[model samples]
Target chain A: MIRALISRIKQGYRTYPFPKKEPVLPERFNGRPVLNHDKCDNCRACEKACPTGAITSQDNKVCIDMGKCLFCGDCTSACPKGVIEFSKDYRLAANIRKDLLVSDKEIKLAQAIDKQSRRIFGRSLKLRQVSAGGCNACEADTNVLTTLTFDLGRFGIQFVASPRHADGILVTGPVTENMRLALKKTYDAIPSPKFVIAVGACAISGGPYIGHTETSNGANGIVPVDLYIPGCPPHPYTILDGLVTFLGRR
Target chain B: MSRQLISIYNNKSTDIGAVPNLPIDDFRETVINSVNTGRRIAAFFGLPHDNDSLKLIIVLADDHQSILHLASTCVKEKYPSLTPDCPQAHWFEREIAEQFGIRPEGHPWLKPIRFHHSYTNNDVWNRSANETILPCVTDFFRVEGSEIHEVAVGPVHAGIIEPGHFRFQCNGENVLHLEISLGYQHRGIERQMTTAPQNRLIHYMETAAGDTTIGHTMAHCYIFEGLASCSAAARAQVLRGIALELERLANHTGDLGALAGDVGYLPTSSFCGRIRGDFLNMTAILCGNRFGRNFMRPGGTAYDIEKSHIDDLRKRLNAALKDVTNAANCLWSTPSVLGRFEDTGILNKQICSQLGIVGPPARACGFDRDCRYNFPSGIFQFKQMPVATWDSGDVFARAYVRWLEIQHSVAFILDLLDSIPAGNIQNKISAMSPCKIAVSLVEGWRGEICHVAVTDNSGKLARYKIVDPSFHNWMGLAVALRNQQISDFPLCNKSFNLSYCGHDL
Candidate 1:
């Protein structure tokens, strides 16, 4: 018993130092969504794949409503161009709701500028996450971003749990009937000027559960989403890029 | 003679014909004949092939490995029930009765299992026909006694544990009977999975049960692989095996800590909890998720394991495992912890076999059943892994078995990591064909998790059935709880750690 006690004391605090020193994240943490219009065929597969209808095509252009997106990564896998990817950047706090909506034109323009900047130099960004009917996969990846390894916060990105405090709501899962009220409630609760980031295919086009009478596919059915992250559950790095794009840090 | 008769009946099937064209009276006779023949009972799922009436499909698995699909059309007024001979079909029949408003003609117990008082009756059933039913009763199976006193605990507990309710009927120190009520954390996962599209449904599959994410995903993926006849990469299979073993290690560590905590051995409990947390952190480092969610896809894994991640995992595993071993050794040396657990909650070998309990709970009681070792999947078939078993059939035996398995899991993880091959992580398949039904069985932390998936011609999910380990082992808990003292309940309960949400679904 004495030896055990001694051993525990010697172990010396393994807890992550959150809110002080930034926690390290994993290599491919699923944090937020970003779109690469250059590679995109604009098939709107991401929009169709979103569980919540977060992505919508208006006049041959894609628009994302971030408010109702869930980060399940269905859209990432559905994208043939590998255009839609998850970025590890997660600083998605916004003061205005309208700022969350990202159109195809805006994304295309951002990608053009980002390519030129990357050619000259190199830069990355931060991301914010929100969970919608997720089994905690998206949440887990978001949390891993702060571990001792990745230290995503070092890149000026942080995951704020509340929509009010968050820059963008990283959404996951096909919004269930039960979670619909909570999703709407969360959107309503978020202060105006918030950006919605739809992470994972479930949030993009209801990746797997689309066209079922039981649930809604993408965020557009409920709220306007800004970015779409596509993947069954988008990798952390893909999420990071999405956040960086949203923040205009890359 | 009786066994032979049952086997014979289980093997032989008398197919009646197309369900829609069958006469109602002839269908009832077919049902009786099938039940009397002793065919392996399967679930009754509603099929809406016709708009005017719903067809009730009964899947019967014969000993010959052939599945017989028996269907009967039900018009609300004149539906036939078959629960009379097949007592095991009670749950399914009641489910169909409540969900589709199709009255099962002579069911002894026809009560609502999933809906609330507000959403009761035929109209509600017709509106939400495909929604998976959930258990609604706040309190099920209440024990009655005059001045015997009863204690109702949980739905929410003081500790950071999943929610479940425990109702104890006791006379001072001795417990007359203990009733468990669950479903507080019902997220309606199965209902969500049914409507989900083919390409992205794996997310729901991974999260169907948190602790058993790998086990569930593997089972789901296996079903899809078999249905599509798509072979996953060998490297992916080995990696999946590694992830599964890691999951087993984490859950076993947590269970051991919880079991130790139940016995008032705080040192062992704290040590085990810390080790479990470390394992979870290791998982986070490796897969970017503590529960190993999103690590698995239909054909293979989502990402490849990098060398640095592997190195990190090995280092952390070595340190954490050392602590765990030392803590377990100390506990074993101490007599108090052992004395309280050794003979408590004894479930004899015979009782275990009769109830069809699987995994550690069964193995601890000398059943020698394990899906990884016996049923063999992925890397388990190629590798040499030990099956931990104990004949004592007591709580101590159960705890010891878990500890031993944890040791095995750590070793397995190490072996797997050392031998992991470099290759592509995923494969592509694009066949949308009918007659696509596949079943996968994985040994979860608790026991065997069986997932069966049926796909339509359009490659959409026709029906998905997941039988969690808890479903088979819950009855075993009730059997063990018999005649034990009230004080021993916590230890007994902890030994099982059954997921109510998994079972309730």
Candidate 2:
């Protein structure tokens, strides 16, 4: 008991103060990508280099879909004039689907829920996470929010085991065929006036496994997603940011 | 008589024509004989052949000799099952039968491993084309008697973990048998591997098992490099090695913490959970993502350590290592933690060997099987890390082995960071040669991650097989539950911590 107490003291408080304060992210961390169309020589190198076909030339202009992007930086490496670069701004969540498509424009971030919805979920948001076909990275990072460092409980967002106890459903993965029914069943189990948040690239646009026959691509068609958190597997802070913003906590 | 299996080295590409395609009888006999002599089957799967035939290829690892033996045999529809003679081939044979329509005759418990449509015209289970196939909807082995009740849990578990079903036949508190039916997490990764765009292959491999990003990606990178006949530079090899160890450190620490949490021990659980994030953050510092996704590429790593950050990296690593030491020591010193862990779930060495389990679980059974020591490649070729083992083959042994590995991994990382070679991190990858086969084995934090890529006449991927450590170890988890308390499932499960999607893939 003494040893445990001493060790706890040595550990100290680990929860980071986010929203109230800026989170410390690594210099190398690739978050929201910026595209400089003016610098593009119309070479279309990045479009070819993109692994998930996230970058495309529409009317000879480059557009990147965060939902499809893995933030792999292959475009940045393939570009000649440095037309593409990922900024360390990790706020990449959005409420609307079209808002995720960025082409030399600042993305419209996730908006707060409506007045009545926020009134209900703003103070205490209980979410049930369903890893339909998640590779476990998204699941792990999402679960990290419950840890001492993230302390998602402080933000009033807890991942409940039963959908009956949740105000929303947090879905991850590409929604494989076998899991499609289960995901729909889970969403149906959550009482009405509940919302759905799709976490990670897989949950939004199938990520890398997009065109495969086994997966339904993402959760969009299966259940109506209210929020989309983007990343191959979004950082824990990114997930928390989405939750807080959607609940109108900030 | 000619040799039935062709011996090959790790990360070395062999000509497709060079691998012996023996008769089915000889192939089965050779595989059974080799496995009986202690050679582990690393990968066994089938590929579509000309006309109506299917070709079965098997890669056997001779750990002691540090060599891989490969052979192939063409089967029209069914082949004599090796699982009857060699128990290790149970899962592999079932997987082959599911992928292609080839039946392993006389095999026990034959069922759909992934519940997917067969690549060929035949269906082993004879379901119609439009039939709705669901995962975990199968006949389970039941003990019918008074007080022989059954408990079924999950395709969607109660936790934030991946989906899989567990069926336990319990007589009161004691479990008679635990049948784990998985396929819910399958996304048809192996099918996608054969047809996905070349640029997207690495991304698929990175997520093959999300937690095992570095391990699977490194294995694929090695396979790609081997096929292209290009190797990563000395510095890149060292960097890859460091990233792999960092992955090991992060995961092993997290497992120990989770094990503590399972037993209701709070101190080590909370501390190690945060410490696991610390290790992940260090990886983020090295590259970008906490999971090390974008860090790996085909020829070499995507990010390189800058000279300016070396000192800071060392400082953080040392601090995290120190924190982990204290956390693990607390776990060990606590009598309650030890009491719950000591013999909760015991898997004997013979059972582990028969099931062909690898990684820490195998090591806990004193099997002495580690890819780093047995099949050295990349940075491991220059410096080897000792294989950590324990004789108890229980939950405590699994946890203690991880603790031992965490220490060794930290020491290995520190040594590499101190003497990081000065050279280019990448080399220009040449076009892959046609009609070639290459095998890459990486010691992922979970265990041995095997990736085998076979290229066609056009240098396109014909068949790419990924054998995650979980593939071999899931059965180990099932067998361990025999005669154990049903309530202790979570603790034992965490001790193994097998991957669901990796196996489903």
Query: Against the true structure, whose TM-score is highest?
Result: 2
lDDT score, candidate 2, position B465:
94
- Cα deviation of A157, candidate 1, in Å: 24
Report how far off residue B381 is in candidate 2 (Å).
0.9
- Among the numbered candidates, top lDDT falls to 2
Compare the candidates by DockQ and give the number of the best one: 2
Superposed model 1: Cα runs more than 4 Å off: A9-12, A34-43, A56-72, A77-85, A90-250, B1-112, B116-135, B138-142, B161-165, B183-194, B456-459, B485-490
For model 2 chain A, where is the 10-residue window of minimal lDDT? A98-107
Candidate 1's TM-score reads 0.70
Q: What is candidate 1's CAPRI-style docking category based on DockQ?
A: incorrect
lDDT of 1 by residue, A84-107 (tens): 666664433332344445554332
TM-score of each model, paired residue for residue = 0.70, 0.99
Residue lDDT tens for model 1, B26-141: 65565556655644344345644445576555544332333334444455433656667555466566656645566777876566543422112354234454554443343355
After aligning candidate 1 to the native by TM-score, how far in Å is the CA of B394 from where it should be? 3.2
